[model samples]
Structure formats: C-alpha cells, structure tokens
Target: MSSKIQVLVQPGTIIIIQNNNYKVRLNMIYGKVRVLRNSHRAFKCIPWLLILFASTSTYAAFTDSLTVGNAKALGLGHAVTADPPGIDSIHFNPAGLTRLKGRQMHIKGVYGLFETNYDLGGYGEYQQGLIDELLEYQYPGSNGVIPPEAEAYFYDEALNSKSSVEGPTVMLPGGMIDIPFAGGVMGGASYSPPGSNMTFATNVYAPMMSGYNRAEDDPGRFFQERGAFTLLTYFSPSVGIEISDELQVGFALNFSYAGMGLELPAREPHLLLWQYGHPWFQDNFCNDDGTPTGTPDLNLCHIVSPYISYGDLRIEADQALVMSYNFGLLWSPEPWITFGLSYNSAVKNDLDGDWEFPIDPFFNQVLLDNMNGSLWPSFQALTGALGLPLPGVAETEAQGKGGKVNVQYELPQHASAGISIQITPKWKYNFDVKWTEWSVFSDIQINFDRDIAFLMLGSIADKLLYRGQNGIEPNGVRYQLNLQDVTYWGMGTEYQYNDKLAFRLGYENRPSAVPSETPNAFIPINDGILYSVGIAYEFESENTLDFSIGYMNSKSHYPPCSADLGNGCNPNNVAYGPYQGQDLRSEVSFLLFEVLYSRYF
Candidate 1:
C-alpha cells in the first residue's frame, strides 16, 4: 500500500502513491488510474509552475471577492504590492510602511455600484418533458398539458436584480452595520519618530464585503434571495523596519470580525424528481407494500417537482476574531527599479450562529396527509404514533436545539510579487503578479447542532432526487465548489504631469476562480476586465488628496446539460437550485469611486 494520501491540488491533476515508494497520476476519466514511473518529477514541477504564473490570469477583485480598499491601490488596479499606499501599506505591503516619515493621517471614503442580471430559462422544461413522455407511454390522453404542480415548482416569477440604491452591510467589533447608498466610511494613521528606522501604523477596514437583498417574488430566490458576508479588519497593528538603505522588511498582525447571513428557499430540481412525479410511480408504489390491507390514496410524489420549494433556510453566523498576518520584503537593487514581495497567511473562521429551516405549509401538509406505506414507516410514526402537530399547525414556532450551529469557512493564502520601474523622471510604472489559493473551497461544509425539517428530508430521497448523492446527513452537509488556484497579472502607470499633479492609469485581467463547470449567478462575477484612472494633488504644505474611479464587468454563458457531473448548466441535479435550462447568462458590473486625504504633521 502506498503511504501517500491522495490530495487534490489542482483540477485535472492528482498525485497517487503505489508500491510503498512510487508516486503516480490518477486519471479519473479512465477505467484505471494512470501512473508515471518517475513520480518525483511531479514534485519538482511545482516550483516551476509558480515561476510561470507571472503572466497568467487569476481571480477578480471588488464585489467579486478581495476588494483593494485603498484608493491608491484601487486606482492602480491593486498592482501596488511594490508601491503600497500610505497607511494601507499595512495590508498591501508592510515594508512600504518603512517609507513613511513623521506623523501622518489618511481619511478615505468609497462609494460603488454592484449590479447583477440573469437571463432565466426553461425552468421546468427538462422535468416536464420527462413527465409528458412518461404519461404518453402510460396513457396517451395525459400528454396534452403541463401539470399545476410543475408550474408552481418552475414559475417564472418576477426576476430580481441588484442596484446601487440598496444599503451596504458592514461588520464591526461591536456589531453589524448598515450604510446608505452602497458606500463605506473609514480612516487610518501612521507614525515614524524622528530619525527612526521603524514605522508603526494601524487601520480598520473591510478587505472583502458581499451582500444584497432581492424581492421575495423572484423565482431565483431559491438560490440566493438575500445574503451578506463581511470581513472587517477592525484592529490591525503593523510595523516596518529599514534593515538597510537597499533592503526593508515588515510584518503585521490583524484581528478581524467576520459575519455572514443568508436566507435561501430550498428545492429539488433534479431529473430524478421528475421520475417520481410520474403517475405510474404513485400507482405502483404509493400504497401499502404488504398485501390486501388497502389504505387511502396516499399521493407521494405528486407534489414533488423541480419547481416547488420544500423549505426556507436562514443563517446568521459571526466570529469575534479572525486572526491573520502579513509579511513583505522590499529590495532596491537599482535606482530606477524596486522589487517587492508579500505573503498573506490563510485564515479559518469558525463561526457561531443559529439557523432555521421551516418547511412550506402546503408542502408540509401534503406530506403529513398523504405519505404512507412501508416505504416510509418512519414518517408514518411522525404523523401518527409520535404525535407531530397537525400539518400547518404553526410549524413556525418549532425550535429544538442540541447545540449552537457553526460554519467553518476559509480565507485562502495569497502571494504577490511586483516591480516598480521609473522609465524616466516623470514616468513610472508598476507591474505585479499574484497567486491565490482558492482551491481550499473544493468543499465547504456546514455542521448543525440539531436536526431541522430540511435536513430531515434527505433521509427519504437520498440519492435519486435531491439532498446530494447521499443526502445531507442530519448532523452535517457539504457543498462542493471545486475551485481552482488562480494566478494573475496586474499593471499600472503614473505620469507626473507636474510637481503638483499626477495622472494614473491601471488595467488588470481577472479570470474566474470558480470552475467553469459550476459557474452560476449566485457568485455572479466571472472572467473580467478592470479599468481605472486617478489623479493626485499635492499642496504647498506637503498635504495630498487622491481620487479614483474604476469599473469592472464580467459575464458567462452556460448551455443546457453541458456541465460535468450534472450540475450548474446541466440543471439536472439542481446543483445551483433554479439555474436550470434557459441558456443561462449572467452579467455583473461594478462602478466605484474613492477619495483619500493624506496629511503630514
């Protein structure tokens, strides 16, 4: 037996061990696993790949995920790892803080628009076709119409969209905050005692903020009706030291608050559900399985459809402290060019929260009244012997807990390297390449302290319908994202128009980190282009003001039944809930503006 554990590092790439001493590659698509004689070669290739990432494309910023909160960094498309911005250097590059002298303060403000639109399609087409075909085979006259239950499940209700008009959610040390008009407020300061080689600074800001509210009538509500995720580095203390004139290094520790809230209606739109919805299924299997003792006409699968929601789930999770750190190095080998590198440690947020999963009243009643037979002996007990309240008897009042719920979430590691080049006295440009370990999201698991109505449903239809292949275990559930590690390039330029004013231009090509196979509107932004411009004004008293504006746009297209594993585009497994058939296309755009005031005292 091979001692090596199979770890999935990248998509389509896996390392396998055999013969106790050999490593090989596993080809999952083939019947047998493929092996290489020189498995050590795979280990040797890792370093080379990182070196090659200098020119590839990676993940998105802003509303997509990691948002560069510094106005200067935003203006430069976040290529400022080599030329970090003022006090915000505590995040971009700690070493850059060493460049600050005397006492300084920077107050910043930001406003942005996050917009998303989706083209919903063939909601119940796939499942309906199956129903019709089955009906035709069983009874030709039944082929004329779509069932009422099917419409309820796949209703093309009012579509929802996100706009800048809504408020923004912010997580702070004390509590969650809400701001008006898609904007944020923050400030930071730094100090370097006279003739000292070290500089110290502190800043509070949100590195990543995501959330939105939509109408309840939206059919897409099944996937994401409303949700918010905020990571606020409320307390960050950092220091930088000048080891020498040519070399500088710095490190910082951050204490943050993370909060996530989501309200999603749940449903099963899998193709298998359509099979059970057939009349033949109910006629043959809906009654009592043992002989002659006939029972009521218990309808089991009639109410089950790809379009009908079974329940609604709302989660509120927060972590008091999310600990993380950053390290950076700056080396100036030449007068015109400087090389910088920085690393951000990964963080795991074990959040504490509560959850409620309430089954729909009508759907609840359907099950309470009609479910019967040996196929569901356990359910029979709940409706009869065990004495569950009558269907729709205000099930909303139910709350039984074994313990508090917790969600384990990860913030992946980040490594960035860049160079600042002074082409001439007035023209300077910066280029950076970054790698983010987004693959940590290959699977995101949720653990529950108590059993809920939604989790309870998985036991009955584990494989053929919904609740994943094995159904969600009563104690835990997992969602597989299968994300990939991303490597991307960013660049920016600053032209000193004169001593008092400078013009900046930046461009970054951010590729989607989420696998194409699982792409959907819930996450929204996809492969995109970021374009930005900014200006800096210097006063006679050495005070400076900077302002910038940037925009990012992305879109994706998924055809019917094209995704592997019957998820996302396939609409066959309800992997993304309501994102079934209609040539799904998603467009997301971000328009943002920022202002920063830096004063030297």
Candidate 2:
C-alpha cells in the first residue's frame, strides 16, 4: 500500500482509521480535527480541533454609571445636587421637591447623541490567500523564496490602504413626567397637620440608552464583530418631608426594566489560531533547525489570518430583559446656601433571549474540499469493501439557531454630594461630585441553554464515551469580564436676568474605567469633558420652558504600540493570538439635548 493513509468521511458521523503510519478520526458537524499516533500507540490530539466559536456582549460594562437626563440637569452639568429646584430634581435629589410650593407638575424630554469612528489599520483585507501561498512555497521549492515583486505587492497594495469604519449619528430618546402633591390643609381651616408640608411625587422615565453597530469587515471583529445596545426605564414613586425650614428628607421606590441586543464575530481569534497553528504544522514548513530559511516558510503566516480579518461572519442575541432603587437628601441652611446628597443601589440585569450564529463560508468550503478530494476515491472503495456507510460531505446552512442565551451584568451604584451658593443676587453657583463603585461591575457571565460541547473535542470525546449511555458528565461554554471604578465632578452657574428669563452654563469630567492593559474595542472610552449651556423662559402664566445642550469631545487613546507611548505597548497585553499586535486608535464624541416644562398648579 502507498505510504499515505486512506480515509472516508460522513456528515454528522465519526470514522476511525487505524494504520501503521497514523490514526485519523473525523467529526463531521462540530468542527474539523485530525489525529496522529506515536510509536507507543498513544494518540497526540489537539483538543476541540474545530467547533462553534463566537463572541457576545463581553464588554458592556458600567458606561451608564452617570447620565444627564433632563434640561436643567444637563444645563447644570447634572450638578443639581444643591442649587436650583425643578421637576428634574426628582432624579438628582427627590428631597429638593420640598422647595416647590402648591401642587406642581414637571415634564421633560432628553436625548443622548453619538457620532464615532475607529481604525485598526488592517480593514478590508483578508490574509488567507497570502497565507496559503506562503505555506505552499515552504515545501523546499523555488517558490519558497518570496520574490522581491511579491514582497512589495504584499505591503504596498495589500496593506497600504485605509479601511476605517464610521457609524452614522445615533440618537437615544427618553422622557420623564412627574406629579408632586404638596400636603397641607386644602381650605383655610385652623387645623394644621404636624407633617403638613410633606410632598408625594411619582415619575416615569428612561434612565439609559446605549447602542452601536460596526461593519462586519472591521478588524476589531475578533473582539466585537458588530455591537450591542441596551435601554433601561424606571418608574419611581417618592415622598419628601420638610422637617423644618432648613432640612428635608426624601425616599423613593424604584422599579426598573432593561432590554438588550448584541452581535459578535463567529470565531474568536485565539480559537482559530489554536486550530491552525499546531506544532506539527509549524515543524513541516520551517527548516530542520527550526530557523527560517532564506525562502522563509509561509505557513507561519497562517497565524495572522485570524487577527486581521473577520471573514464576514456573525452571531447575535436578539433580546434580554431585567429589574433595581435610589435614595435622596437636600438641606438648605439659608436661602442662598444649600447641600444635597443621593445614593443609588446596585442592580443585576439578567437578559434572556433568542440568538443567531451564521455559518462561515470559508470553513464550509474547506471541509467540503477535504472530504471530496483525490483521496476520497480510494477511501470510499475500501470502506465499501468493509461494509461501512458511504462517506458524504454535509453542507452546513448559512446560519443556525443559537438557542436561548442568558447573560448577566451588574449596574454599579453611585453616590453623589453637591453644594449651591448664590455668589451674587443674579448668579447662582453649583458644584457636585460623584463616585461609582464600578468594582462591583467586575465580570459578565454568559451561559446558553444548550451545551456548546460540540466545539471542543474534549467535550465531544466525553459525549461519545457516554452517548446513549447513562450518567454522562455535562460540559458547556461560559465567558466572563472584569472592570474598574470611575469618578465624576461638575460645576455650573445659573444667572437670573429677570423673572422672565434665566441662563445656565456648566462643565463636567468623567474618566474611563477600563484599564489600558484590558482595552476593549466596544467600550472605546477615555477621559471625557462636557461643556454645556441652557436657558429658561418664564411665560406670563408663571409656567417655565427650559432647553439645554451639552457637547463632549473625548481625548484619543492610542495604544502605546500606536502612539509611541514611553510605556512599551505589547499587542498581547490587549488581545490574544493573531490579533495581539493590532493597535487600536479611537476617537469618541457626544451631544446631549434636553427640554423641560414645569407648571405650578
């Protein structure tokens, strides 16, 4: 018999080939793997040769820790902790409602706007053909030496172009309505309740809305192929009591709901490298001394394929939903001087929903070609003689069901303090500071109803050992994430030109919670500063109309590898496998707008 071993393959079936040269096994549906036996008959196998691999919302951490929800809040840089009082105060500090007289109602509309872009340098190119050509020439042939023309072509035409990804403007809308009832005797009767100044209020609003979608060809696809979005809304009923003219306390019952959608690349970069960069494959192409020859082995280039290209594939979760509380205090020692504080409790959001995984065309074609190639004729003839089932190549659909997916994330709790001072008769100055326990946002857990053992050979072997048998061990895929804490501060001033008009200006700063060593392309955030302006017009009816606008242009953070930061940047610190050396250069900006209407009844 020829030195080469013959083999037959079947869809969704396994075949064992035992020969003097090597023992090869096939697993049709999950992924591809080949096994070889040594002299001692001990099989050397790389686990999970091939399996389903994809990414989903691994980095949707605590970006929502702080938000400017209303016009007065935005205009004042959300520093309302101690200064002016409005319906939006219910969010900043419910106790502030004690300052309102008579029955009152407040309505406000808010929008979070974003426009962003990123470039990882390797956009719009695939390294597969280049890798294949390099590997083929490593076979001690003249072609093994890449010609100067070929080397030039690889850098000039293949790598020199810009493939930046830009997203259109995205707008997230939310609104709040509040009704506060000031408690006192309805008529001018002599009877006075001890706690007559108590006020009860209820408000409903969307607290946070975040989403982004990237092109499939984007190089960062290995980390976040597409993107994700989340929207959270809450209904709060509260009571505020003015114990005396100088002090007030507030309590609110918080009921919240969250919905999320996410999509990611199919195969994680590391997994692809694990499957293709086996030591055996490396030894075959490199020189006997393990040093690169003058021609250099091209198979080494296979390592880069998983890093630079996304293969235009995706897996997505359609929806997931969860529920969480907030407490407030406001103290006014004098008419011009005030202090405020608030604490929001942490909440865990568990999102469960449908998911989708699209099959990769390149992987499918490769599997088909291997099964139907030149060796199939002899392999089929032998299997037929041995009365084995005829081998057939199974065609995978472009996509498959991703069963129910459940992912859990923690929304961090935040505490804030503020002070407001009337510097002059017409100018009111405010200062606020906030801190979030983002440490609690450490990790995200992703679990699926179905066992993803189909991707790992170890799980497959265990499944086979107990298939149709009782007492089988269970195995599934799980992923996690870790994050850090953040701080924010704001300063604002409101000028009352007259009873009919008021002007507002403020500034705030928030720093990134993501560590540089653990950078994620999805969250792509940094130190941010927001400059805001607003105006309030009082109608003859004594009702007020307010509008505010906020603009934020964040500083760019180029990984040390990209910026020549004194601290040397190692691609492996940020990414794994082939994607390790890729540097990320990102710029992010935001625009916030709000409108509020208040009426005293």
Candidate 3:
C-alpha cells in the first residue's frame, strides 16, 4: 500500500510518502490542520495538525552483499543496474555517469534500524545426561563439590526463552563511530568537460555493515555474544565513455577498509561421558571395599558434566586496505528501451589482529584432581616405554592463544543485468537479476602467531564427538562456513506526475547465502523480501531531491538434534556445537529511511 501527502508552506513545500510490507510512518510534516466535515477535506487538513521530519538518504547493512545504495536506487529496490542514480552511479553502473551533462554533486544520508529476535527451546531426549550432571552440580551429595549457578541458568531463566540483538554500532579505522539514530552519511560527485564523450566521478560509501551486542547471559549469546563487521568504500574513482550513439561503457576501481571482530564461548553437550553412570561399571568394577580403579589416584569412572564451556575465543582483526573493481555497459536499442550489465570483482583480505583463547578452569581441574602427583609421571613413563608416536601425550598440558593472529576472508564477486522500459509517456518499468558467488566462504582459516593450547590436545577430543581438522597443523584452526551461491531479483515501476514530480514503488526478493544445513543464531537470516516507496521531485530544472523508505524481513526455524543429520551441528562451525539439540526460531528485520539531494551546475 502506498500514499502521498503534500503540505504547502508560505515559501517552500513539504511532502510525505508511505508504505512498506513492515514498519509504519504517519501522514505529514509540521503544519496546521482544520476540522473537516468531509472525507476530502479531512485528508487535505492532515498536514495542519501533523509534522514529520526525515533526513539524509543512503543505505548500508550486512557486509558487501550489495545492500547499500542511494535513495533513488533503494526506492527502485536496486533495480537501477540499468538506470543508475546520478553521481553515485560510480558504484551502481558507472556508464550512467556519462548521462550527467555538467559538474554534478550528490549527497545522501541513511537512517537504518536493524533488529533480530530469537526463540530458544529445550534440548533433545538424547541429552538427558546433561540435565542429570547439572543437577548433581546444583545439589551435591556425599562429595562436597562447590554448587554452581547452573540451576537458574538451565531451569529458572536463560534457556528456552526469547532474546534480541542490542543497539547497532559501526567500526572504522578511527574506532567506533555512532550517530544519533544508527545512521550514516555518504556522497559522490562527477564532472565532464564541455561536449566531451567522457565523465569522471568518485564516492565514499559502505558496501555493507552490521554489528550487534547481547547481554552476557542472553540465550542468543550461545552462538556469539558480540561482534561487528563492515566494509567501507572510502575511495572509488570511475570513468565513463560514450563509445557510440547507442552504447556506453564504464569502469571503477574501489578501495575499501574492512574490519571484523568477534567473541564467543564454546560449549559441547555431547553424549560421550554418560557411560560412567551405567550400573554395569559400578557393579562389576568396584571391589568389596568399593573404589577400584586401574591408575593410582585416578577415577576413570567418575561422571563428567557436559554443561560447561571449554573457554572463550576472542578475536579482533582489521584489513587496512581491500581492493576490487566494477565494470558496466549500457545499451539502448530503441528510444524507449534500455539494457544494462555489470560485474563486480571479488576481493581476498588477510587481516591481522590480536586473539585470546583461555581454557576454562574446569578443563584443567579434571586432569589435576585425579592425576595430581606421580600418577602423571607414571602415565608419561608408560607412553614413553610403549614407543608411542606422540611421546608422553598424556603428560601434555591444555593450551589457549593470547597473542597476534592472522585470518583470511573473501568478499564474493557478483554480477547483475537489468532492463528498463518506457511503458507509456508517463509510466516506466524496471527489472534486474543478480548472482553472488558466496561459495568462496566454504572454509575460513585462522593462523595464530604460535601453537595454541587447543591444537595440542585436539587428537584426544577428536576421538569423542568432534571431527578433527584433516591435518592438525601447528598455529592454525579451520572452520567451515559452507555458504551457497545465490541468485535474486527485483522489479520496480514509476509514474511521472508531470516533469516536476515522480512516484516510484519496488519489491525485491533476497535469499540467504547460508545453507539450511548450517544455520544458527549467528547467521539468522534465511530468505527476505523488501518493500519500498519514494518520491523524486525536480524542484528546479537543475536540482533534484529523492526521498525513499523501505522495510526488509527474514525468518528461519531449526529443529532439535539437526546435527545428527550429516553433521548439521558441525564442531568446525564458529558457533561451536552447542546448537546440537536446541530448537531455534529467528527473525531479522530492517527499517530504512533515506534522503538524497543532487545539484547540477
């Protein structure tokens, strides 16, 4: 649904437009309204009693998925690959810059509100031991073990509840930059010599940006507690040339700064430790006096709880410079129809930063309590006497990283094709289809400056429920992202209400790059739909203003124990294996408002 309102001031004009599949905005800007006795008069008087104020126009969310654009492109649901927006065309379709007659400038600001909500449900039936062990921890018996806070965490609160992401934030080189309303500003300019067949332009913009913070105990934190990722295209120089009467070609070199930081604790509630509770173990293995274990001071039959975490992995990395390129061509066969094709190159980034992975005390206590003294020495001697390939492996200590690190990430390449048709003298239609090569993220590799503790003990843990890396090399870890390539499209229509005003409406279907077999709270998005409305007014022959507002939403649901099916809950996942038996329902939504002003001289 779409509606437009206009309020005339003594010296200037004010207008408001509405509609998105989600989110709501009112009728008018500041003005006066009179009591109306008729429907016509009622709508006409809306401005008298209301006021609406919106600011600069631009778009930036998610990272490098082409979710960023100016007001005009967004208004048309980014179907403008064929009819790019003024100076900003340096990014969308550089060939379009050749259409500008003289020196022109475009300024845009964006107000972006992004929110994610998740519902967590109980674990599966196979995970009963997890509850029993936690119960013992909450209320110890003969053994005077310290009572942990697991009671409230599992039963009273936290689990099987709802949680949401906190307010948004953006990270740049200078550090955190926050605006009044989770917004950002960007601009561009272009110039062409008199009667020349070429144009040059530059712009500053974010290809995609998103970040979130959650309460330490928030259920959603099970996946990741806090993180931020952004790619800012601070410099892009472009050139467009009119090759012939009907063809235009262009190219642009984009240089950007990207930062990615994350912190998450790892938890694994596998079924490996439940064998100690079996009746057979106690009935047959215990001596008449009770307590008969093989190794001195070691209790191999002691029950081990699976509710706790190994420790937290905190990483903060940034790439100072990332480079990519964009090239596009525009063709006009008839006066009323135009065709466009564009390609964006992929960029690989090697980031350097600091990382720390501290092992939980519980991980150390298990080894310390049973093998406290010469028992550890005897185990080391036994392994050495056996001529084991991993000499004295049982004597090796657990480890973690707390130093410099390097990681590899790639921004996928994508291509788009668009068509624009002039239906009637006052109507126009545009459609575009795009493809993104997201499969480049199948595996993410991280290298620590030195051998981390976890890798040293990786072999033993891999024998349990985890699948180890093919080759456990020193100072390295690998996680499988397994993202899928995707294709999506959008359509838009415009009505020219005389030469001074135009109305535009658009819709786009965006699908997730993450596959269903590997979804978790971290990548909550599935498939999404975007709804948009806007008004383009040429207040003067040489100046134009574009206002656009949009809403986007995506939802996903995962059943308990999905991991049992082809390792759905892969341990190599950045989120770890905590999601194995928990049901999750997630929704991610965005509300956007933008204002773009372009002036020509």
Question: Compared with the true structure, what per-residue lDDT tens digits does model 3 show for residues 1-601?
Answer: 1212121112111111111221112211111000000000001111110000000001111233333548888888889988888877777788998898777766676777777787876655534445555445446571423345433234324357897866654545543333234565566666787889998777666676656566787765545565556676666888999998689999999877776666666554444333443335555665545465554465554434444555666777778788999999999999899999988888777888877666667555554555565666676465446432121223324244377878776767889999999999999999999988877754456677765434433422332224443223335655444567888898888999999999999898887765665443345666779899989999756699999988887777776656321112322321234545677677877778888888864
1-601: candidate 2 lDDT, tens digit per residue: 2232223323222333333444435221110000000000000122112123323332333344233256777788778877535544455676776766555555555554555545554421223333445545543354445455444322322122222323321111111111121000000001112447876554544444344444555544444434433333334556677888888877666554454444444332333343364445555655666443443422242322332232332233322234446678878778889888987777777756555555455554444444555665576477547433233353123224456666566777878999999989999999999887766655544455653323223233323443412111122332233346767799899999998999999898876665565444435446678889999999998888888988876545444233211111232221222232334455666676667777754
Candidate 1: tens digits of C-alpha lDDT, residues 419-456: 99999999999999988887774444568775443344
TM-score of each: 0.78, 0.66, 0.77
* TM-score, candidate number 2: 0.66
Error of 1 at 158 (Å): 7.3
Return the candidate ranking by TM-score, descending: 1, 3, 2
- Model 2 steric clash pairs: 48-457, 51-455, 134-298
Clashes of each: 4, 3, 12
TM-score for candidate 1: 0.78
Query: Which residue runs does candidate 2 get wrong by more than 4 Å?
Result: 1-68, 111-113, 122-195, 216-225, 266-322, 364-400, 454-480, 560-579
Residue 225 deviation, candidate 3, in Å?
1.1
Q: What is the lDDT ranking, best to worst? A: 3, 1, 2
- Let me know the TM-score candidate 3 reaches against the reference structure: 0.77
